[model samples]
Target: MPETNLPASKTSFVKGFDKWNIAVASGFYNQKIDYMIEEKKQELDEKNRKYIYKMLTFSLLIAFILFAISLYVSTYLEKYFLKYRKKIYKEVEKNKKKDILLAHQSKMVAMGEMMENIAHQWRQPLSIITTCASGMQLNKQLGLLT
Candidate 1:
């Protein structure tokens, strides 16, 4: 290097300029970093919102499907119960008719037995009355009724 006569004030001014340049560059980088951080935060918030919306949609779809299936099952059960009820009613009616027929047959048999007993009771009384009347007629014909 050649020997040059540089003033102390000029050297101090150069040092101040370097410090000012470094400060300006650091401020610019700091501002850029802050902007990047804000953008990243906004992106994360948007993603979270979308995720929540998708979850809500999926849940609603599942609920609707469950509701539909329950309705179908209820309808099927109602129909099945109704069909069985009708069949049971028909069977009950048939059993009632059979019971009535059996009761009528029992009554007829009891009446027949009662008639036979009545005929047996009257037979002896009728035979005694006929014998007494015949004796009275024979006595009157022989003139012994005076």
Candidate 2:
């Protein structure tokens, strides 16, 4: 067998690296992976959008059902218990008024009693003072004061 020699290609670092088929293949594979990842991301975004819309729709439906039920209950209450509720309120009001009237009457009676007591007290003291003054004047006129 005859010996054969091949010359090595001498190039700069940047050019040599770029010119290799491995680099080209790596770039192509990297680009393919990026594209695939972007496709999956788009699909996930679409799924998320659908899920959000469905959830929103479900929530709105539940809200509507609750509102309708509340309205129905309100009607039923108004139809059934309206008269009783008003009757209870009127009874309470009547009792309250009666209590107020009784309190007022009691206060007036107490005031009258207090006024009578005050008049009686003042009259007794005034009478005693007048009697003492008259006795003093009589003694003075009779020369008993000296």
RMSD of each: 11.8, 15.5
Q: What local lDDT score does residue 68 receive in model 2, on the 0 to 100 scale?
A: 100
Across 5-57, the per-residue lDDT of candidate 2 in tens digits comes to 43433223332354554432212244445769999999999999999999999
Q: How many residue pairs clash in each candidate?
A: 0, 0
**What is the per-residue lDDT of model 1 for residues 32-67, given as tens digits with 9 covering 90 to 100?**
457699999999999999999999999999999999
Error of 2 at 137 (Å): 64
Per TM-score, the best of the predicted structures is 1
Give the CA lDDT, 0 to 100, for residue 124 in model 1. 76
Poorly placed runs, candidate 1 (over 4 Å): 1-38, 127-146
Looking at model 2, the pairs that clash are none
- Model 2 / residue 121 / CA error / Å: 36
TM-score per candidate, chains pooled: 0.58, 0.41
